[model samples]
Target: MKKTILSILIGLLVVCFAGIVSADGIETGIYYEVDVSFDDDVEPGDSFDVEVEVTNIYNQNGTYVDIEDINVEVVIKDIDDSGSDDLDDDDDIDDLEYNVDDSIDFEFEIPLAVDDQSYDIYVTVEGDDENNGTRYTETFNFTVNVEKKRHKLMMKEPVVNYETLKCSRTTEVSVTLWNIGTSDEDVEMTVYNTELDISEKSSFDLDAGDDEDDIKTRRSFVLDLADAAAKTYTFYVKAEYDDGDERETEPFTLKVEDCPTEEPEEEEVTIVEEPTTPVITTPAVVEEETFMDQYGAALLLGLAYLVVIIVGVVLVIRLKKR
Candidate 1:
């Protein structure tokens, strides 16, 4: 009779503890059920060292609980690995994938191949056992902070005559802008008088392929060689754009040399001589006498006398005859 009573009491105790264990998964020190925690801080390119501890509280009946499919995933936001500052304003980091080792004490350190930003850590557990049938698995989450550096442009090709690559006469040159940053970013470029400054001024976008085109167009400014000033004055193109949410690009240079000038040529002259002295010659002539002076007075007197004499003779003859 005593043995039967003892057996019943043991069964009752088992049932009570089972309820408590189910209510609050397994527990060990600060680790409650299935929870994953990282070790301090993590940076880009650095590995993630995390620890996970699980609790399994139950009587050793023929049926037992077994933890399966334990996935530990470390995730952050989206990144193209170039120049990017797109982050969740509210810290929205989701676990897109996971890693598992099927062990109670699990550790994960994945080589981070992404941009610099904070990430949220996630622990997922799939638990299945014999005695208590199947139990509810646990999931824990946390976040970590990270940061990436921006890109820098270095001008290796000097502002010398790109074709000849030297300063001889007035000439144009082609320059190259190098992407010295490990990461990628877009570069906007502008030009100013020798000294560089950022303004709306007419600059264009430059990609990795042709960084040269960044400062292709420049504003007009007089560069006087002054009598015999140095052949050329060097100007600069200041490239500015989003580099990891910031702006940069330093000392983009351009050289301006004076063209060779020639002195004015002398004017020529020609002359012709004029003739001297006037040449005059003699002209021949004929003379004549006046007609009236020759016979006018005598001829008129004789003509009057003759006419009177003839009239008188006629008158005498006619009287006699009658």
Candidate 2:
């Protein structure tokens, strides 16, 4: 029994030694690449995403190999102007598992809340490659650059010189803008109406300052009300800066009234009688035409008068002979 136990112990030691040799050989064949990228135009007090692509390559016995399973973790360090090595307050990402062949991607979000200045982010990626339960830990370090942030552009309520406008007329709309940040801003103002035509104010430079009066810059937009109707018109104003900063103001409204109408002129009139009345002749008999034609016609009266005159003359002659 003692001899058998000794032989089993020797066999176990040999198997352990073989695994150690295989791990050593595979470590030399393992290779990886780290690529880091983030937004370069990120502003202060804003959040942005950073992407890291980790690619692992392995070859054993002169043939390409694939890692059956792996786990990845990341640590972020925000380096100030003065470099420091301590990472007590740094951000740490938990472990994630994946089956990797050639490459894998990891994404993280970074929120910046500091002054408008340049900064650097250091990232450390820790991962393990497991092939048949043999684990190899791989680590890579990379740096990302963050540029200076620009200030915000602010706009006040717009003003209109005229309270009301008439059709086929033009007016001006005034607006003031301020650079409320740390740097100067090149601003352009655009003014538009839903029912009227207006021109924009462009290319105005403004400097930042603590006092509101010093930093304020005003511009005027010409609004033409030609062919506009009689109603209220709202003008929307938007201010854009050189660094893609934008601000919009509340709608400014103006009234349009119809012009007064003029009275028409009156001309002299003349009345003249017609030379002859218009007669309507028909084929019906005169007696059936009207009541006056049946009783008071001129032709019938002339015959009755002739008969009376002849009777009177005969009676006078007969009286003279008797």
Candidate 3:
């Protein structure tokens, strides 16, 4: 047992040494060629898609061996700086393996978040060596722009008016959408209320227009309000076009007002060949009066006395006898 343990430890050291140390400085049967295709100019805060293909070009065990499976990771650096030889984060690389049945190709996805005017993306591919425990590393570089992070979702009627029992209420709102992608593409949009619980915002189809109206997408919502207050409800609009997607547009709030409800129906009774009594609605008394109303009413009362004086013959006779 001791001998077996000793043998395993020795083997581990040998493997670890073999992984990074080659007379040629880490030679492995696995090789990677990474190619990227993206929009030429990515605008600040724009979005673009990146596709990476890693081809294995080598042979193993006297047989022509191809990289069966490998995972590639991407790192973004300042345009002025080059990436480090060592990985920044351990999770930068994904674990991938090639099985006898699955030995064909290796693929992976990564996103580039553009925070600067321009940046460089470094891609690293790691794979297992069949003969030894050595790990083969391959790298590729690409340039990115802040414009690539530029993405927008436009809402025409951001604030929807909701109907209520009070007059002067409104709630239905509609909006138009656009791809805004550097390339012509379709995006999935999600809408949700931050304060109030609302139905999930659904996806809409948008395309970058070549002709008029080609870049526009139309969508609408009937925002509902149960209360009679003018409080604001915030909604979140986020879009994800495809793989390597991210979010934008911090949650924004929209003020909504209550809409008036429909008037009640009037029920009428019918009589055949006979006149029907009219439905009498009593006049509502005005309890609250403005200053002008009170002044006008006092003026009319004073005018009544003046009219009595003009027709004062009967009143004067009664007053003289008294």
Candidate 4:
């Protein structure tokens, strides 16, 4: 009976040792050492990289065991949110020989809405042993601190009442400014065109709030192109705030055209004339005489002489004939 009891105790001890070895993977010879590297001062709304180096360890028998189908994954856990991102190109290794080290890079972007605080980054390495096909998983994590900039300004696309303006005309230019930083700001907005020789400025205050209305402000300027020439003009809207922190919108174009000239209208005219009076002419008086009355006496005397001569000639001719 005493020998049987001792043998039973020994068997029980052996069983417990085997369970420990199996649980710790000492017998399977699939162990790994992990090293993670990253930046400590991570900012919100920024992307960072975490490099993991996984080294395979030999078994308890002092023999090298190959690991196959190795995969590395990474996740970020904040106070209120958690997310996982895909690893870089070299995220997995087909086979890792004994005592060899492999590395993978994981890129994570901090959400813009994330608070400025500490975040936990968890890295998991998983693989299978080639000889026994036993799967092994190891997890590691580290903390990252996030901070925000105190003076940051963002300018949205400017809205213009007229993209194409006529010369000697006025246009209304409006833009919205956002205070995305941590502190309130006194913003100075300017709308300028160098070629047009125009510069207009306005000032306002913005609160550092996450809401739309609290952190946003709109400003408008009346750009008078009265003296501007007719051509393509490049204009820029800039915001200056919070100790020389400046932000500018992308350059926008405005086409200024010559004002159209209207032609003069023709007018019809009517001419009025005064009535003319008739002119009276006087008649001239002249003495009137008959043609026969004036020459009657003279003609009678001449006729008498001619008759006497004719009578004499006739008598002479009659005597000669007898």
Candidate 5:
């Protein structure tokens, strides 16, 4: 009976020790659960958000235990030929009570050089028990799908010959379109300014390739500002491809000024007058007296006196003879 009682006591002691060891060796008192949310269709060279909902259910010794110094982090693994990136750690969560939950957002940007493939995303949650200072960590992972559009058209910045234009003048505007998609595309380019009532469009085919010359096409247009006002005008360049998809460039500005005033021209006048006839006049004639006309009158008076004297002499001669 003594040996049986000793064996029974040894068995009881072994069971109690095992129980104590099992209770002390509990891996964690904090439970972690996560819910992830993201976009279904992801693309390269795009910025997106990944929302994570974290819940903590703390239970220790049949009692609720609070956790403190909580931190959350996120990392995106590299895909084929793509690079990896890490989000900043969110350590502002000081403590979490039993059955409490919180949400975090991780903003991510895919590299422009990434390929069309799936990538892995990792989320880690770490904290410590407030009572015993035991560290607890949990990690969760998910996948993100990345794909590129089959037909994508992009417009480069427009090359304008003049930023400021004069009224009744013209400007040359040129732009280039790029086929950055996976296949060849037929592109339609348009440059327009609704306020100025100016619109121009052209169509061309572009071969899809990585080379700059292979995938790009250029077009030029001359814009007449004959009826434009003297205020600011905005121009836009748009590209349409693959039957419905389109892209537009940033707004370009062109300022118009009023044309200068022109001075009036003076008229020339010619004066003409008929020719005048000259007058002619004749002078009167007066003859001057000669010397013989004056002497003829004196000679006639003397000859009359001489004839009377001769007659007296003849009478005297006749008286003497008687």
Candidate 6:
């Protein structure tokens, strides 16, 4: 009877200890998961580096758990723009390893294609954790956003010899072309003005992105103003790049003015003497009277008439006597 009682006490004690062990053997929780990032803006056909780090929280209860056989991978999937559909797998990274509480940093290069967009980067880490001397598997997932690449072309302001030109002189107008896309481009630049009889075409190759020290080809169009009028003239500039990418600047204007005249030279001054005044003379005035001269001529005429009457009487008597 005493042996049976001792066996029962031993069984009860074993059951109590088993319950305690089960309570103390829970899985260790993850402390933190993060990715090292340098650039948030990514362009197409670009290769860049990405990093990842994971840490485990310290267990406070009974048994300590350590992880092994850690395999880390990076997967880029093309998720829809609305982010509702299942992601289509596009790329995968190779396997890696890590331990519990170990700071795992993974650095690798990822090359993006020209058509890759609306995607997500998923970093998955799998490892075996020790739970009360028993190993269990665990997985962790992390995500990041990859933006779409931009393909663009731009035009710079044109250079000209004169904003206000002269109609009798030649003017040189030059235009510089730049490539702002993600790859090299074949560019064709043209400057034309039919009114001025100016048409010049030139072609060149440009590199991707902006550089302060980059060499650029400047195309020049010579405008002969021999027959041009004095007015505002508009010149058109066109730039054509890769895959039918074309851009044109606003109408550049040049004002033609009349040519300036030369100034006359100054001459020496000399002093001269003034001329003398000339003398003047006046004529005398006359009076009108003739009554005396008329009376004298009348008396003589009366005397001659008396003599002729006497001669006439004598001649008459002589004739009677005959």
Candidate 4 lDDT score relative to the true structure:
0.70
Clashes of 1: 7
**Global Cα RMSD, each model:** 23.9, 18.5, 29.5, 18.5, 24.2, 25.5
Which of the two candidates, 1 or 6, achieves a greater lDDT against the reference? 6
How high is the lDDT of residue 112 in model 4?
42
The lDDT, on a scale of 0 to 1, for candidate 5 is 0.70
Error of 6 at 213 (Å): 5.0
**Quick one: how many clashes does candidate 2 have?**
0
Give the CA lDDT, 0 to 100, for residue 230 in model 4. Answer: 86
Encode model 6's per-residue lDDT on 1-322: one tens digit a residue: 9999999987665432221111111222242233334344554333444454544442437434565555555444443222333332222222222333333344333322222333445544455554433332233233343444244445668888877866456778878654445566677777888876787777777665334223245678876766677888888888776655655564688888888788998896888879978777676666565776658788888889999999999999999999
For candidate 1, the per-residue lDDT at 117 reads 48
Candidate 2: clashing pairs of residues: none
Best by TM-score: 4
lDDT of 2: 0.55
Q: For candidate 4, what's the RMSD?
A: 18.5
Give lDDT for model 1. Answer: 0.41
TM-score, structure 4 vs. true: 0.53
TM-score ranking from best candidate downward? 4, 5, 6, 2, 3, 1
Distance from true location, Cα of 136 in model 2, Å: 76
Error of 6 at 17 (Å): 45
TM-score of 3: 0.32
**Candidate 1 Cα errors over 4 Å, as ranges:** 1-32, 35-40, 57-115, 150-322
Judge candidate 3 against the unseen true structure and give its global Cα lDDT, from 0 to 1. 0.49
Better of 1 and 2 by lDDT: 2
Cα lDDT listed for each candidate = 0.41, 0.55, 0.49, 0.70, 0.70, 0.53
| Model 1 lDDT at residue 148 | 38
Q: Residue-wise lDDT of candidate 2 within 1-322, one digit each (tens)? A: 9999999987665433221221001211133334545565544334555555544554556654444444444444543212332222223233333323233344443332223434444333334434455554444443344344356766778888886986446778888776656677877678887445564657778876444455678888887786777888877888877666456565788888998788988887888977998899988765455766666677678889999999999999999999
Which residue ranges in model 3 land beyond 4 Å of their true spot? Answer: 1-30, 59-64, 77-116, 131-133, 147-322
Give the range where candidate 4 is weakest over 10 consecutive residues by summed lDDT: 20-29
